[model samples]
Target: SKMFYGGVKPEMVSDKFSFTEGPSTDKEGNVYFTDQPNDKIYYWDWKTNKVIEFLNKTGRANGTHFDKDDFLITCSDDQGEIWKISKDKKVEVLFKGFEGKRLNGPNDVWNDSFGGMYFTDPLYERDYWVDFKQETP
Candidate 1:
């Protein structure tokens, strides 16, 4: 098979985390994942073969995807919003809500071929949202 990640088997980088989700890979083969319970995001560097903590205080980010600009887009569910993050660790809230109502909780995100985005808003409660309430149906 000369096509497609030929025989690329899943490799376990580590088993240290409270809870983990949202694994996204960059063009450079670096893998980024989230640990919501710990409010942290980690990345596995292809060059170094190491799992490095990329950021903390992640807003309980659940799912992540890379945008056309190579920005790491994440569903910052703790705020019921989406975030666009740069390589330098700069963050910007891209979307908050729709129709004047708060989102349920953006759990995942995916980018279209044309640079548009698609995401999932599921009602996944978090410990951080102390006064939490689902504003929309």
Candidate 2:
């Protein structure tokens, strides 16, 4: 059996982000995370010990989860949509709006074993939004 370093302590990865949220990992142990205020997703390569931008202009992604197919499902708060990102970095909108009204804002997402998706929508004010206002639901 392989023994690991039991005394290892958590270390700071980076301090340059405005605000960080939604951290997930792939099967290869590569970590993916979002910086919503910056509208970017970062990739932390386990083998390289380096962090780089995986995606930019990401629609202010907040939360993310990896599906069974290894695709990345993310909450895009900028437009109240859910996005699916492929391995090739192609982005497709999964959920746009609920009924006729736009969603409040997608905060997080999860994939079930039955191939179902669950996400959270919460109303929050954004400085970039000028065309829409929050409505009572």
Candidate 3:
């Protein structure tokens, strides 16, 4: 069930790149979103109707989820790590690798009621990579 605010209009904040990925709301209904390209997290308060940077250098954080314990879980795409953000804003890496090699990139994630988490790896190419040479025929 999707909920809607009474009269809030979605307006552009700036020409800046938001690069927003997963958006998660807290128990207080405050929404948190990621700006992966710029490596920042933003917060949109329902009561204030404002967006503010919650964190910086988020490790290219992508998908975000909140656990039953109120900890913020984020899938960091840059380093392929899942993080647990405590209430005190302390971040800890919950997972770094699955087998041995680094994951491609955590594109999205979710948590089950049974305390299990699932994530996706879809980063096939680096954002800064450039193909300067073509295959020789």
lDDT per prediction? 0.89, 0.88, 0.78
Per-residue lDDT for 20-117 in model 2, tens only?
99999987889999988989999889898889899998889999999988999999988888999997899999977888778888999999867899
Cα-based TM-score, every candidate: 0.90, 0.91, 0.80
Candidates 2 and 3 compared: the better one by TM-score is: 2
Q: Which candidate is the best by lDDT?
A: 1
- Candidate 3 stretches with Cα past 4 Å from truth are 1-16, 128-137
Better of 1 and 3 by TM-score: 1
- The best candidate by TM-score is 2
Tens-digit lDDT string for candidate 1 (1-137): 45548777767788999889899988787999999888899999989989999999888888999998789999988879899999899999998998988998899999876999999998867667868778888
TM-score of 3: 0.80
Worst 10 residues of 2 by lDDT: 1-10
Instruction: Kindly give the stretch of ten consecutive residues in candidate 3 with the minimal lDDT sum.
Output: 128-137
Error of 1 at 2 (Å): 13
**C-alpha lDDT of candidate 1 relative to the true structure:** 0.89
Residue pairs whose backbone atoms clash in candidate 1? none
Candidate 3 lDDT, tens digit per residue, 1-137?
43558776667654555567899988899888898888888888879878877888888888998887778899886676789888667999988776665666777888877888888876556674244121211
